[model samples]
Target: MKYRFVIILLSILILSSCEFSQKRYKPDWDKWKNYKWILNKNVRNNINSGFTLYKKNANFNLIRYNENNQLVIWEFKHHNYVSIDSINFFENIDLSNFILYPGQTFNKEDILETSVRINSDLDIDLHLNLNSDSKIYEYINKDKVKGIIGKVSQMSLSDETGYHQVLFDFPIRSYNVATLFFKRDDSFFILILFPDDGLVKDKLKDLNLPELNE
Candidate 1:
């Protein structure tokens, strides 16, 4: 009976450790090879439905969703990149003539979408729920991107309550971005878009684009 008690204690300790480890906020930054094209499984059931994001007619031509946990890093150019998955979400992006160009890389600058497991260890929930406006602005300001005040709106996606924002200027302010966050069970997915080289900084202000919610 004494031996059985010891074994039970050890099992409890192991389970507690596993739970703590899974809840930690250690983000995986490196590993670009895990990024995958949406043509395979990310697409909708219809053959006519192309491999674009939840929106339509945006300058964000080339799009790719990351299959792994790490955030997709833009290899070159001045496209905006989000480091923290919790703060950056997706919404309104403009369509462009951008496509697989001769010189530009394919997967790097395209649409980056990834789902992160929601847990208390990352403090993502705290920042998102408690004073999210201040936290988001603080992070974006730290990136040296000025006048980027994102107003998050709640939207429904297939029976799920998702967060939406248009022209989310983060990590990079030069590019107009659309990001969306949807909670599926215990995890939330973020979809971010970057315009092609043809859409320059000078033209962004002039274009009157529609929000993804429309």
Candidate 2:
């Protein structure tokens, strides 16, 4: 009987340690890879679908369910030697339930507001959001270039295509974008981008609209 008690205690300790070492953020990258493509038929059903040219300095392509929906932007560089990064934003949503890292939490609503404010304050010409099936998608394109700004003379940088484009640059901004969202049963999935890339940002944005802000 004493030996049985010792074995049970050892088992409990092993399980506890294993649980502690496990990763809290479960990742699912493939969920949205295929979803990123926009079928030509999607554009036909949504007439708001089209790419916009902004003063030859930037390009934006989008599809919308309505005019008031929040915009989603995806931008990147196309140079052979240069690579771009992506960011994803949400409007009027409670994103705290979604885990990004161990003991990390963020509000989806705040992210959207910040992006809106930054682009608007910079006079970067914020695009319109189109809503459908409850989701809104927006795509943005910019000159592949880099610059500097802010009070400390903070260095600003971007690719020739105007996107930060790397995953490493985002930790400072407090984002660990996991584009894979589990399906209804946590089996299949959906891809969500904090900052989307131009290659598929527009394509994904052209997908079915998500539910609206309540």
For TM-score, the strongest prediction is 1
Per-residue lDDT over 1-214 for candidate 2, one digit per residue giving the tens place of the 0 to 100 score: 9999999999999986666444222223232223223223544443332222121112222223233221222222122222212323223332222222223122233432211111211112111111111233332222321111111101112223333211111223332222221112212222233322323333434444331101
Candidate 1 residue-wise lDDT, 1-214, digit = tens: 9999999999999987776555332323232223233223433121231232111111122223232111212121122232233343223422122121211122233233222222212223212321222222222222222112233221111101222111122222233333333332233334333343322232223222222113
Overall lDDT per candidate, in order of appearance: 0.28, 0.27
How do the predictions measure up, each by TM-score?
Answer: 0.25, 0.23
Compared to the true structure, candidate 1 yields what TM-score? 0.25
109 in model 1: Cα distance from truth in Å?
30
Worst 10 residues of 2 by lDDT: 147-156
